[model samples]
Target: MKQSQSHDGSNAQIGAPIPSWKVLIADSQPDQHDAVGRCLASLRHDGRGVECLSAFSAREATALFGQHPDIAVVLMDVGLDGPAAVQRLIEHMDKATATWAGPGLRPRVVLCTRDPDQWPERAAFEATAIDGYVVTAPMATDRLYGAVLSGIRLHASMIAQDSSQKGMARVMVSTAGIFELRSSHHFYFNLLLQINSLFNIVQDSLLFVVGDSAPKDDVARIRAASGRFSALRNQTIAAIEDPRIVSAVREVFQNGRTVQTNEHFAFAIKTRYEVMAVAFIDGALGLSAMERQMIEIFRTKATTAFSNMMLIDELNASQKAAVFALARVAEYKKNLIQGHHKRIERLVSETAREMLQRSFHPEELDEDLVAKVGVASVLADIGMMVVPDQVMHSTRVLDGDSVELIRQHTIVGWEILRDAATMLRGRSILAIAAEVALSHHERMDGSGYPYRLVGDAIPISGRIVSVVDVFDALISDREHREAWTVDAALSWVTEESGRLFDPLVVKAFRTVVARIREAEPDWLATEIASPALAGKITTAKRDLRRMIDRITHLLN
Candidate 1:
């Protein structure tokens, strides 16, 4: 077998002109290879000429493929050694190409034969992955040129498609990861940028969303934008100067369907609750059929992601409402002052924010944890609901038995929240609430509560709520005692730093108190709930019934 080389009878040189396309010609007859090479020596496609690689046997052809991995087309003789040798060469090429170029990126193969009756076109294609068959009895140069060019074009098209598919997969994974991090704006903006990158377009794009509670006359506002449209984010559609884009967006919103026009493409994404939003791709009029199909796939995936985010938001809201209703019921049963839990919630939230600002417990602190610990703090005394009314409301000093019974509320509250958390498949807020209920009363010195946990052994959530809960109780008037002065309560908390509270928590608590004193000195005197807190109270009655029904279902 002869060694493979460029048609010039020498190895390719460093300064040799690079051809736009490479074609391999494999046959046992050296004259056949030379004749085919001579016929196509001056031919060019897309203004660039082709380079031919000569291989004298099946083994030489396989070796040529290894040397030139970028070869776009292969011209093989069906009877090189036998049908078996040709088949073996094809299989080897397939495995080798697929390893580097991927399964969808194999080179195009065109078979040549002297006897057409032995290898018909239909049988040639079915038996092997050949792109074309040429009858070489007369060696028609025109037929040979046409077949080789067609194979090169087909290979180029395959490479384009494979690249598009890979780009789409990467975009999907990146968008999903951003969504998981809970930044909806970042996720949407990243999707738009990726769409442009995938299609090789530099056009402006805009994503508009209309809330479910929006009025009929309300216009969709831009949530995310790219290119020139980026400056107009959070603006209504009317803000865009392009009449063509405005019309397309309106048409999509009105019809609740995708709109394709001569100048733009607008897609209305629908979630379970409503027609979620519209994605406007400006200057997308000339997208090919494949590009359009890829956009549709992206739209479908975006819809699923939108629906999932909405579901999670709804679930979190429902959990918070249930917790508030349950806390209110316990407070009412114990005849505690109104707005007491609300104050505790605010105090806990403030302290948590301060802790995060100070970088305390950096690994465990985040915005989500701050929000959850505050809401869960309201459930710290949920065990009070199980205490007897007489023992809870007694004006007289409590006896030893009464004191022990009162302490049991901590254990009882933990059990209730722990069971509810289990029933909810371990919802994070409930798990934190269970920890607060169980350990909030325990002192840092191992002296307090049912479990007597010491220092950091107690969960951070419990430690945070313990300090804030005590501060609120001391400053608020109770049935058995008058309210202490703010200064006295603050001094007591500062003095009990490590003995009765987590030192880190107490540190944050001091900062929180100082801020409150500076910003809202009369905050403690105002028993009236803020508008937002008042709304929560107004819904408590309605949510109480729902909470009971849910708990009943969980119990069953």
Candidate 2:
């Protein structure tokens, strides 16, 4: 309830990189937007002025905030979206504060209402991070200006003191990448690196993740050492010879409280998954009382981020397991070859990774692209489950109508994936999977399937999967024909070129195919009757010219 100084452009940092502080206004009234915008028109601080954003509805407000993570302050009309909507928005912003890595910043919230009788109860949202409260009735320009300026100041102050928050935010960013880790080795080791970076990176510090002493299915040994002890980055504790450090780790794990001395510091935090994480700092311990308090808070925040990342990985693993089960069900109903979907997944992953490695399509291959494509590729032919058995396996040659009906499988698979739309709405693998399911059959030249989407219109994922899907299907057995030879399959893909595949995608696919041929020429020669080559292909040792030569015989 404290007042803010009237903005006279005195506080703005001159020649700073930022030109303005973005202020988003959420209200349904056309006049209100104009009023707030006009009031702050000339308002400047440190040479920075206010840029007002207007959102007319709750959905609009959600979208605006989602798009503009740099929004410094949000002034909302509680009566328009109502107090309940405002509370939900506040809660969302709370969960999001530690995830942003941009400018080391967080948004400030102010609730405004025209009616005193309809004021939002302070008790309901006080626990949330609302920075100011404004009542419009009998309100003066100075008071309004004070409220808005106060919100911006609060935001600036939060940013100024964001050392700990930014630490937590960086940890969250790494933890977010945890969901995309393709292997457990990378997951745990990368997690250790992230956790160590969250601290002061003390040399001679050691971290011990003690699992259940008893032999259990999930529990495993993990320990890491840094600084003077950098040799133990990915090492276990079984080979330790330093009795003093070993004993210190033991005492901390046993007592489960942070302990420090003139030259040593130790702390333990029990994770949500029932693992004891104990760290012993072996460097300087000159931290004052306040510094120690801040360290403890940082530890708690970092630990929470770790737990949340683990939970997301678990959920993603479970969802993928279920999707794989569904795909297996589809395969069973149609009596398709074993590991049909698995082969396609491996091929898609292999081809996509090659594209990324050689910079064929850099923009499309973000961090999660590998894991997302891996999970989503299995659902590429999931639409086949909905196809009637007669159409799926009719011995007689089908008419145009039946062929078209078969083509509808892509749409059917997409609809099934899209059913979980609410949970997979963003730039996530599940959404990418849904898109691939619907559009993988689409061709570069508008020559293939139900949609006939061309060129870049087909998602990069879809284009990658399309090339993999056809090659896998061609080289695998079916009711109609035996699996084609590897040489024949690659030649067919090459022949299609711009007609059936993205030229760049095909170029990448050819190299991947050549590597597969080099490593396992047997998989290339005969029909792929089983999951014999379900594993990912390793990097090829040969030059690109040799790969072309291996396939040139077939191309001729």
Candidate 3:
């Protein structure tokens, strides 16, 4: 599968397009001739795609190299002319000093081999003018394209950098020339303007200074751009409000490179901004070599302007984390097993990764989300801290007040998160987990707590975590109830899908549960036999009792 796509930072430049470059191939074997010829010909014959020139032998290759200075690449067969042909070819290349020696002529030579191991002069051949090597038998077209593109891009960058350096050197030597300085400034501004134009700024597009200490108006403009972009597109910008993205962008600036995120960040210059405007921006925008180079240039020119803003933000996040930890600590005093947050986070993080890959949803989950899910999972049960020990630990029949107190925990979790904006950013996944914690008790038939968000109204993430939370709770015991059999719990959950849970999320949850059971059947079996199960089964008994009660109540 060709699952790879090429990307570089900076939108595609709308400069005068360089003319298509030609390729040359040198090989002696007639049997090997057709395949190589056909592939090169295919690229060229694809209509203004590429131009190819072929040579039958090393001698012919040298002649062609001399004849066509415009040829961009030469694919040379290492074992072509004879048993010693590959070595001979290397000698010729060495004599000519052709390795990165084509000045003004950007010809990349890649050694093509049937078997790199079998090649007699493999090391010598590799050490010569070859920019790269491509294995020939059953050649993968995608790999071939990748190799070719990589070589070409490298060659282009080298040439481009050299040209820029030479121009700068000339300007430095003639520093007294006003016209040279003026031309250089104009060149830079023009480059920026042209690149901006290539981004195809629509009505929602607003320019913002992207460095750390950039003007306040710059940050405001970006926020405004995000709002306009989201409203025009009618999409939620929660990702923009995510803090990880801001961290990622800071990483890019610190390293002087382009940072990309699908999580909604219109853009941030600093590390502190908790909420960015939510918009799904393509990551390819910031992954290109050109984008990295351009950003490096930008950072060099505006260091102080970007740094001041980001440093302040870093300090703010540190302070916020400290306060949030303190609050969680105070709440934990009432109910222990504070480790539930960490455990749940790990479980959900793993499960979400599986589900994201298995399904075709547009969740755009990456490593960042997975890490956040783990952290948020721990905090999911933080709300349980709000409930009194009597209600949480009771084995006797519970009264309405106790049930309500337990129910309010979810709402409390949400409220707590809303107040901590920094946690809100790094732990956006926590918000989803918080929502799930708040409503995990809800039934599919609009019987859930707080908002009773029915059907799709409950975010997919909430539903996913809800199922996992319930599963973990079910297999574990609580003071109020006994744990249920895994089979019984799965059956009940599956039966209640759509009415009590998301049908798809439920199915995915089941898959995850099944996998875990397969990987460690003894853990499930032991938990089923003894609720204590090494003191980790805190909620198992209560869960089993609740399951029995719910099932019996439903049957009645």
Candidate 4:
């Protein structure tokens, strides 16, 4: 990794070794855009070159976004306004590019406009998502270049994360989604903050949920709401402080139904023991029916998540830590695939639930089975814990001997769960885990290793786990390969249906995947690196074996 130096001690310049970034220029005015492009045509940042893409109008920009998602930065004119303007187009373009259907890139946008007066103000830009901006001033060469370089750096960070910020924003929200609240005011305030951030509700909004009440001695209400309703909190008596709030509360309580508008949304959730929990969101724009529906669906999920979180809180601290430790046990020591177990667990759960809803497999895959599959799948690779780091993290290809040794992990993991008659004596989840660990690698066509059980002989848990386990592995980056897109990975699954997987299970998986992509568009966009290194290492090991065998024959 040493840099070469010239006779005079100056570092030698390499022959175009730096990667090129795709930067698109979107402007209606030919002269302005061309001038900006011409100036920055030869610009380089962090030794990386720039590849320019031109789009004269909003339509062309949209088309280019689909064609080249790898475009790292965009400079668009804002005069088009609304759908046609660069400002609005950036918002729509984020949604369009946030899927694996294309090159899986997230481009940073910089607003460029000829009208100086029309430039976005600091307050507006700070609150919204305009990355950079430039007015049509004469001496803007340095200014524009600075903006573009700054944006390119930001885009680089986004690429490194694989998924864009927009896609991951919902993960936090989803984790907080609980079905019931224990009138925990701390949790309620936090939940309110989540809703506000997710939907971009303003400070002026009156956000509150009234339902079950906690003990007054420990509960801190009214004035301690952190300015959510500062005026209401400051009121001495705290009775009928706001007539608007009173009317809304009364309406929700009386009707016992949900209400919605551009400015408000109300969902009266019935908590455990038939206690009605009235949740209201105010001063948020309704945007569209689809968006509103998305919010409602997330609300339901959040409620469930909340209930689960509460249940977890009730568990002994040691038990909770142990469960989390089990999930993390699959992480590799070196530069290997991280979060593989968790990814498989989530996908398995989703796919199982999706399959259960459909009549394709009928009797076998139901809600109870799906729950078992999810819980069991978490430890699907527990056998890997016993596999040596040499095999798991080997940069070079592993030979048949090594592979065979590593494959024993399935048996090893299952044996630990099943053979441990004392420790795991009556744990249902462990029994399910044992089944998955042993048979998850078994193929539909009897080509899989170990026992090589074929078709339905493979447990449904094993079948579903096999599909998602391979899928997460395929999409995750390895030392040998770049990550494949979600589209590519799923297509590969479809291609392998029946031969390597159950046809009905694959169908169910596809339905689940489609629903997930629909529910969270960003889910479609997240993909990992390829395992090309793994392939190379395997080839190397086999060649070594062949050479050694030939040498032994010569010695004989």
For this target, which candidate reaches the highest TM-score against the unseen true structure? 1
TM of each candidate vs. truth: 0.63, 0.56, 0.40, 0.40
- The candidate with the higher lDDT, 2 or 3, is 2
Candidate with better TM-score, 2 vs 3: 2
lDDT of 4 by residue, 73-96 (tens): 888777654323655566666677
Sort the candidates on lDDT, descending order.
1, 2, 4, 3
Q: Write the per-residue lDDT of candidate 2 for residues 1-556, one digit (tens) a residue.
A: 1111222333322122444788888888777777777678776754567877788877777778788777788888877656778878876766676676334255778777787567654753564456777776654567678887887787766765665555556656655665555443454555556555555463566666765333333322445566777676545665567776666777777777677765677777566866667777675555544456655765676566556655565566556666666666665555654466776777788888888878877877765786679678888878887778898878789999889889999998888788765576465656777888998999999987777788888889999998988887788777678888778888999999888898888998899888887898765433432333223112221332354454444323
Candidate 3, residue 62: the lDDT equals 71
Give the range where candidate 2 is weakest over 10 consecutive residues by summed lDDT.
533-542
In terms of lDDT, the poorest run of 10 residues in model 3 is 1-10
In model 1, how large is the Cα lDDT of residue 99? 93
Q: What residue runs in model 4 are displaced by over 4 Å at the alpha carbon?
A: 1-321, 334-338, 419-427, 524-556
Each candidate's number of clashing pairs is 0, 5, 36, 26
| Among all candidates shown, the one with the greatest lDDT | 1
lDDT of 3: 0.52
Clashes by residue pair, model 2: 9-44, 11-46, 12-45, 12-46, 13-46
Candidate 2 RMSD to the real structure: 20.5
lDDT for each residue of candidate 1 in 1-556, tens digit (9 for 90 to 100):
4433343223132223435578888887888878887877766654456777888888888888888888888888988887677677778878987898888577788899988887787888888767789998889899998998888788878877886777678657645653563435555676666666666668789988776333444568888898888899878877988888888888888888777765677787778866468888877355546666777777777777777776665566677777877887876665554577888888899899999988998877787788688989999999987778889878799999999999998899999999889867534788889989998898999998898888878878888998988888788766577778888998999899989998888999888888888999888763323335534654665766787787656434
